[model samples]
Target: MRLRLLLCVLCWLGTTPALAAENSRVLTTIKPLQQIAAAVMKDIDTPALLMEPGASPHSYALRPSDRRALAEAERIYWIGPELELFLQDLLERQDSAVDLLHLPQMAVRKQQQAHNFQKDEHASHAHGHEHDHGSLDAHIWLSPDNAKVVARYMAEDLASVYPQHVDQLQANLAVFERSLTALDDRLQVRLSPLRDKPYFVFHDGYGYFEDHYGVKPQGIFSLSHEVQPGARHVNQLRQQLQAAGPSCVFTEPQFTPRLVNSLTQGLPVTVGVLDPLGSAIDVGPKGYEHMLEDMSGALADCLEAL
Candidate 1:
């Protein structure tokens, strides 16, 4: 009788874990997507994020460990080939067991060229150096509207995989949407003064942000860290910056400031940095909201300084 009880206990223990594992396991590409996945899987133990702090997904090469994690995850979400160029083949080859959530699926907007950041004399100035890069701005999470779409998708995915959590996922989605709506209202009011304002960015990742807020960026100095502006593009941008006389020209942390310095030379413009991602500021758990707020405040401060 005692032996029978022990066997039954072991069987129950094994079955419980197997059942739990069958419920859900998610892995996302970036920190922003991690936060979204976290909200959707609020009831889960923990989800995984592929990109780490200070890691550049633009040119990140996958390690063997990364491949193992991707193969193990139940679902994985990312902005698509624009950023994860290296993962394209891996994703395609992924077994049917792993679910892939490509954000730019049926709702993909027309793609745009990345911002330019190369100086006119980039090639000549390289001290025996050559750099090759092909990446468009993959910072789609910067826009609140896009965030809403992703949040909704994440919630649906969570519910679909774990039907028992359908109610919980629905509630989470409503809460996420409400938070986004509140953030959007605050941003609209805060950025109202600068709605029609002409500005410039070190990179062109702000197109969605600018479009949503009715602001027009004067020009893109660089697309990603790897892209450099050619001589002709630099001259054209220089002329535009001079003509527009934008209040501020922004740069990011990951890239060089060489292009920024060259473009703003002899031009009356204050240089500021806008982090489309929440690296510079402590945006809190709601990092997406924090990113938008920091950007608005930074732009406002720059404009007021002028």
Candidate 2:
């Protein structure tokens, strides 16, 4: 009886959460990052999403629970100073024990590479708002290549913390790569039917998607929401619409589309709303896949209608 009891205790100890929970606590700043972490942590528990769905990372205020989570987190992932400026101070204040990964920093060096190319191209880009010196577009995960980089980093982070599960983590990453590849293939097939269709966006936020998919924007209403276009610029955009032959004018959900309506007055131009922030979608537990799918479907719909 004593021997049996001892063996039962050992088995229970082996299966307890204290033994398995070390690698389970992951915290990510945004929904997209959380999705990448989810892909990498397939068999593991879902990560705590710091910024909830429909919340803007730019203006997210931390709650008391969020503060505690950040302080106690074993691993945290974020895009860095470009997008989540608010989290900079909190992140900086953390002690040395915490493991944190900055996705934009680890993934791409676009700030250095794209500057020279864009300098001459955007020489007169003075709408009002100042650009960051390094000016890294924190929106790296928007690109499939960058998403792969993030997945790699996530795998590394998981492996580092839980070397015992390294094989499992790598296998999960392989599955993630396969899934992302399949998603890209599906997007390519859907987009093949509308490659030549041109559109205008309220902002130049679609550069990553456009570059990846070879889609072109005929005109941009603005670079950032901070600045409104001048009267001359608006009129020029209006004239471009008139001459471009019924291109889709994409507006943001948060922004008013009245300007677009006035610009293409009496014309049959298609005006569609594109939410780069995944604003319109639910983006809850299973909503991440739906969000990306909807974006692609929305673009396809707009292009087909054109």
Candidates' C-alpha lDDT:
0.64, 0.65
Please write out the lDDT profile of model 2 over residues 2-77, one tens digit for every residue: 9999999998875443223233377778777777777787775566667666677666787665776777677878
TM-score of each: 0.74, 0.73
User: Which window of 10 residues has the lowest lDDT sum in candidate 2?
Assistant: 112-121
The segments of candidate 1 whose C-alpha lies over 4 angstroms from its true place after superposition are 1-24, 95-107, 114-138, 160-163, 223-239, 280-285
Best-performing candidate as measured by TM-score: 1
Candidate 1 per-residue lDDT over residues 136-210, each given as its tens digit: 445577677777788777777767668888888878778878987898898788777876566776544676777
Deviation of model 2 at 255, angstroms: 2.1
The pairs that clash in candidate 2 are none
Model 2: residues with Cα > 4 Å off, grouped in runs: 1-24, 93-134, 160-164, 223-234, 257-265, 280-289
